[model samples]
Target: MSGQLYLGLDLGGTKIAAGVVSGSGKLFSLVRVATPAHGVRSDLRALFDAAQATLAAARIGWPKVKAVGVGVPGAVDPRTETVWAPNLPGWKSVPLRRLLERALGRPVFIEADRNVQAMAEAWLGAGKGASDLIFLTVGTGIGAGIISSGRVVSGSRRVGGAAGWIAVTDRWQPAFARLGSLEAQAAGPTMVRAARLALRTQKRGVLARLARADRKLTGETLVRAARQGDARARRILAEAGEHLGRGVASMVALLNPELVIIGGGLAEAGDWLLAPLRRAAKKWGQPLASRQVRIMRTRLGADIGVLGAARCAMLEMEREKKSNVDFPSNQAG
Candidate 1:
């Protein structure tokens, strides 16, 4: 059953996506559904529905699916089958793997969402052909994926990519505590926060003029204003780039990765973001590490999560089959 069909589920804060993948990394049928706001049960139901819909659309069934993999945005304990997904509200220590496996009546596995993304990029995206790489997603929060020796690195507990939690600033109050996180300073919401602060100070800047009273501040508008030579917007983005660069510098020092692939909403700023990032990283990232590492934006965009999930499912199925063939069935699981 080598190269058999696979199913993948990507569960996120906004939506859940499911896809049927072939051996060649080609997705046959895909579907998306709004994430359930209530709780884990609601969310799991939606995920299952999306998976089933994709399966039906592909004209396939559970028996034909060799394995299923799910990518979730929280801490996952593969050994215990429990997930500590706080964003899902009531989903803490939920046995997601068992639940999905029983529901699908097939072998199922779960991985941290960011790790899955990192793996896909390392295997098939821009990081392809690199033995050591890092994928830093600079969005609502900053998470990283470490690829070592051409494989995704999972720490003892699979919490390998919690880069946003790293402390960057010292002058912080409880209100300003979030600023310590690289993400809190560089993510899209952070740019909006900067805009609001600029507005309150009545700064003579482009941000005050572009942001309407009723609208929310976002990276897109901030970039637009910066592109048009708005001083406040340019300053905010430059500061964010510096913060992000420092974070990458730290990662490079620790992992010694050959490449750092940046993705997320803020990456749209392109050169405006990269310039300051490079400056700050070089300032703090040390002599050798910063010189050796190359930071580039992700090429896969939004499809990374889905594609990663599919790749994870395929790899797990292959490993499981090899284990079964090498040992008795009772010893494989």
Candidate 2:
């Protein structure tokens, strides 16, 4: 945290977060705005407004910021500076970097949200010391940020860690149309749906009672019921865990990462979800890869996205400096 400060933006389906972070990975301040449901116009306005508010709250001027980084919840191609975000309607290669740069008057780098989250983890979270690690974030959709040999494996198409797209089964259901097989089976919405379906066969339980009453059956509901020792709720989570475990096994076999850090809404299920996931990974993963990999839930909680975005900006500044680009001088304030 001894180096210059940078600005980072984390854009999500529900909110947009902006923060000031140090080169050494300390977040100084943060501001958030609810994402507008109208359209891209509203979203862009909120994005810019959040940035301005973040700097104001930090008591820092734009000139004091070295650069900017954005984390989008989708695929990002740095070569083309385009994004393919499923959550953002009518958005594809929208030139997000240019938009932010024009508004903020600084170099803006846009990255995949998973990559950004992984960056934050590698910097100061669960992955701090692991040279090879996977940040598997499971929420609206499943995705991964893979760090190999201390560098992000963005792949040739900048989609190296699209973990949700992994096929956990041979059967393709209609639910897999939008999200991947693994995600369709294990993500939040999918888990909720599974819990509701379980109510058909298991007639009496906390989850069953909720579904019978036509009340909202959300991820939180499932976790609460499972914690209360509801068999049906625990079974739903275990089923989802089976699919997630298979997904983990595949990643372990292919990437051979030292650590797999799970984060997001579903990871809060604790051992109810993790136990089966670990068992499957050990059972199905390549023997050598399975033996050494350790899986754990993220401790950073809600702050991961904001911190990741800031860390991404800080890292981009370092990258530009290494490439002999004209790095901005961060003068003392």
Candidate 3:
């Protein structure tokens, strides 16, 4: 057994996942629990319970954990150690780091979920060896993490990677004001909404039938339908991809990253989405920069968030060690 181990937690709206990760990015044991939909106190308890179960499953104790890192699905201000996640109600400006540290009796670090995913990619996934990279997560929501010159660009306000807010249209919808312009046009809900709106006028195709049949439509349903050769579903996906591609093109023009890795649930659309996205990027992106960039899907899959959290903890541990290193003092005459 290694002397050093880290606990990594991924806090999502529906579930909380915890894992005991080694220094080499290997996950020893993982545990998951349904996230409490209401009450901040209950959700926090659920998080700790899941962590305890994960540690027990790994046959480890809290004493073995060197540090803990959490990746949260919201805005996390590292300076303030606070979090503001819309999905988790009543979590506005919550002192997450202090709370976790108190509960676990160990040093704790909290970071934005997208940033952790990007960190994992830079350290061990598709973006490995790349100094300049962009990780775009297109799931139920849209967000991005930028790694420029081998360092994460967290921005002055720590919200630099909020790519969902990028405006892609000349006219703004009220929804765009809340969900961000790019996300309003391209995210999972947006895709389903577009399909539903299309079905309202034209009553044809599998998507239309599915929309009429199922009161609730999801991005997964659309992707599955597209795979089965549904024209409407394919069209909807392509439209969403074009919007995402435009956003990507803008990112490439501004950052000129060596690689852009797309992850998250919507990424499952695969070629149905990527084909149109690549075409749009070529058509709209800055000529030279777009041509030189390589965009690919994430390789880390479901473990990206947890692994990224572990990486953050490892980095924090290293920084503290370096800062505490002792240097021989020169004797004063």
Candidate 4:
């Protein structure tokens, strides 16, 4: 193995984190920069600059880095190096890999952000010892990554595990007919919306105090109230958990994964979310299938994306090595 370091970039909607990770999984230099909210070009420029700064801070030039791996918040085409990001507008077919490679003068690999997170968990986080696992991030949005047979499972177009968009309801009307979506019901913003609607009613509980603390309700506030034993907050969380559980049930039936790792800002609700979700999964999902899957909170915290990206880079490097040495070479006389 080469004694070179790897650079990992986690380009999220809110922030871009870059770090130099040694082969032994030691992160030497780390830095974070706020992602530009203006548009696609601005965000991409900011991300590339941050990567350059991180490399400089580590005192390691692009020549010393074996590979540059990036995790994006949306789907990426490995063939075209295009990113289809919904949150980031005007990013369709962006030549991200080529752009980064041109700037850093190194091999650049790009993968779905959720896939990177799952890889991180599988390599060094909650799913380390587990062979089959599902990673769920429930925050501004809900998404998933599946690890089966000790490999990350990416469907065609690298958009395999979109758990958030899975339809839960049958009604398909455009306005009040958002029936088949876990994101529509249980994501962070959705939880706040539900809480706000609940507040309009006569239900009185800890949420009232929380709402008073911040006029605009958020998932953090809802979880805080639920933790304080507020009835309204608990009720709101319980309802959302039920919906989330149903989604988990669906996951169990389809994937039969050994473990489900839940993360993101909203997952901090702890048992308030897990308990109800478990009950709901039991009621909706296949009993035998759900029995095999263990749902737990992520232990990786905010570093999962970077770790996952590093893992991805390492994996790609390994593949390149194997292809170079193991494959038979053709020669002409």
lDDT per residue for candidate 4 within 169-270, as digits (tens), equals 775536223322777788777788878888888456778777887876778899999899877778878888888888888888988988888887778999
Off by over 4 Å in 3: 196-216, 324-333
lDDT of 2 by residue, 1-333 (tens): 335888889888667888898876677888878878467778889999999999999888898888888888888775687888876677777888887788889988778888888888887798888889888987767899888877788877787788888999999798777777888888887887777677667778677666556577778778888998898789888888888899999998988999999987778889999999999989989999999999999988767887887777766666676875532111000
Q: What lDDT score belongs to each candidate, Candidate 1 first?
A: 0.77, 0.81, 0.83, 0.78
Which tens-of-lDDT digit does each residue in 1-333 have in candidate 1? 345888889887667889888777778888989888599889989999999999999888788888888888777875687987655678788899889988999888788777777777876788877888888877555678777776677677777777776667775646335324676677777788887788787845566566764276666778777888887888888898888888888888888988898876577778788889988888888689889889898898777778778777777776676864421111110
For model 4 the TM-score comes to: 0.85
Candidate 2, pairs of clashing residues: 1-24
Local lDDT at 212 for model 2:
53
* TM-score for each of the candidates: 0.83, 0.87, 0.89, 0.85
C-alpha displacement of 297 in model 3, angstroms? 0.2
Check candidate 1 and list the clashing pairs. none
Window of ten residues with lowest summed lDDT in model 3:
324-333
TM-score-superior candidate, 1 or 3 = 3
Off by over 4 Å in 4: 56-59, 173-180, 196-218, 228-232, 324-333
Model 1, runs deviating above 4 Å:
1-3, 56-59, 175-180, 196-234, 324-333
Worst-scoring 10-residue span by lDDT in model 2: 324-333
